[model samples]
Target: MNDVYVVGVGMTPFGKHPDRSAADLAAEAILGALDDAGLRTVDIEAAWVGHVYQGMAMGQRGLGAAGISGLPITNVENACSSGSTAIYEAATALKAGAYDIVLALGVELLSTKFRGALAPDESDIEAQIGLTMPSVYAMRARRHMEQYGTTPRMLAAIASKNKFNASLNPLAQFKKPVTVDEVMAGRLIAEPLHLHECAPVSDGAAAVILVSGKKLSQLGSSRAIRLVASALRSGKLEVGLPDMTVEDLTWRTAEAAYQQAGLGPDDVQMAEVHDCFSIAEATRIEGLKLYPLGEYPARVERGEAGLGGRLPVNMSGGLLGKGHPLGATGVAQVIEIVKQLRGEAKDRQVPGAKVGLAHCRGGKARGVEGTACTVNILTI
Candidate 1:
């Protein structure tokens, strides 16, 4: 099988884009990625677009807006993992030689879709029981506090850290850093989760150009970042209640990615995790084995997960500070990794970052750990 490499990455500034349609945002990102790759519309061999709550034919509409037509276009939706799943499919196709060059775009216009906390489908048992994303995460935060003695202050610190990182990210939604105390004082969304600790309703898009090893050699692109691994897994039905503090889906998916890359957590220099909520960062990093279970709060306290720390995480500000435009989220995480690997993340750059991991977990279903989870590893 051929290896896959990312030749270019692009993203719209993640925030409220009331004036933009999803197609327009996607077109902007697509154009930016094409320009970054030093390629044109005609060079793309195939495409996949990810979205949710946007009617139909999102892939065709977005690509057509970018002047791409007469090529295969697939639309994917796996909740928040939708965009990352598109990348996984594109990479798999490249490895199988089904396509030499592929484009993966993730776009969402949530500002016009929903007003408040996002929830699972109405048919979901959890949703029927009045469980919104915030409440679910709040329950997890409560569990962590009960099980690990994780304090509310620590959770607030995570939000502060991510927002501070966002302050350095020009494209991030939350440009100003919030103090931990300020975070603690913000209006409560759920028990331990404050408004500042939750990901905002964002509207944006991100796109990436993937090329097979053969195509990369043909193009001789010096900016290429090798995609060493892309692993995706769906949540399994739980036979019994499981620990909310741990993420089995994330662990399983990340383990597959690590094996594929022939590397372990210790080798990961930095990461962009699905910090949909403040507690999510702790749970996900532990699930990926990037940090010891139940110790992440302390790690954050020591600044071990900050930009200059031992293992910087969410340098893009993550879903929390960067904004969570579901479909755009996963691809945006990969873009951040690509930037850090290419030495192009500027102010939020992790120094000498050679290997990076991007984790995205999405959706909740009845009697399942999670609906979908994806782990992607990249190397410079």
Candidate 2:
């Protein structure tokens, strides 16, 4: 087995891209990564592309637009974890000596796909009952409040923090920071959840070029970031009414990743967890054990999770401020971690970041805790 390293990372601005085709966005990201890696298309041994609503042959179409073809290209779709799952597949192949150099890309043209709040598949019972993502998270928020004494203001504070971080990010969708009061005053989406707390619909793409240890030695690039672990897990069926305030799936996935990386939550210097909603961030970090259960809200309020604090989370502005383009999200998270590790994140950079984790959880099904979850650990 070969050790895998990411040589380059790239992401398009995450926001409305109604004028761009999915292939175009993917190609831009792919080329940007190639340029960053100082490599050419011919250097890629194979490619994997993750997307949800881009239909069939997305891998072929995206790579074709990037002037890459005649190689094995696998298309992946695992809901919101689609992009991260693509990275997981690529890493597995590299570790198994299947490829010396591979490209993993995630793209979505969500602006032209849907409008308003997103829901589960219509066939799902929850979707049929008109339960949306906002409503589901709202219920979790309410429960956390009841159980942990969290407040609506605390959730707004989370939003304010991410948006402020986004202001420092050039590619973030929402550049201007909003106050906690602004977040609180925003139109209510569901009970206890305002529009500002929800991740907006976005269209974007991101890409990373990974190489084996031998290939890295051949390239002699000093910018390579080692990928220590890439772990994925699917949610299990609920036996009974489970605790909504906790995320068993996230904990299990992070445990697997930490084990594979030979590290623990204490070693993680920074993180980019799935923040589809304000409440999601609080629950995810808790599940990852980055913060104690029922203590993240207070920690966040104390500036512990912000940049230059104890442990910065979502320095890329997260989905709340960075925009959630479904397929692109997971890959984008990895890109942020890569940048922070490389000391290239400028204003939002976490000081002396070494070990960073990226988490992505997606989808919902009837009677299941979650659909798909992925955690990737990287180190400089």
Stretches of candidate 2 exceeding 4 Å from the true structure:
none
Candidate 2 clashing pairs, residues 3+ apart or interchain:
none
lDDT tens digits, residues 206-248, model 1? 9999999999999999999999999999999988668889899
Q: CA RMSD for every model? A: 0.7, 0.7
Per-residue CA lDDT of model 2 for 1-380, tens digit only, reads: 78999998888999999998999999999999999999999999988899999999988988899999999999999999999999999999999999999999999998887999899899998899898988889999999999999999999889999999999999999999999999999999998999999999999999999999999999999989999999999999999778898899999999999999999999999999999999999999999999888999888888998988898999999999999999999999999999999999998878889999999998888888789999999999
lDDT of every predicted structure (CA atoms): 0.94, 0.94
Q: Which TM-score value belongs to model 1?
A: 0.99
lDDT of 1: 0.94
* Backbone-clash count (model 2): 0
lDDT of 2: 0.94
Looking at model 2, report the run of 10 residues with the lowest lDDT sum: 362-371
Task: State TM-scores per candidate.
Answer: 0.99, 0.99
True lDDT of residue 338, candidate 2: 92
lDDT of 2 at 249: 95
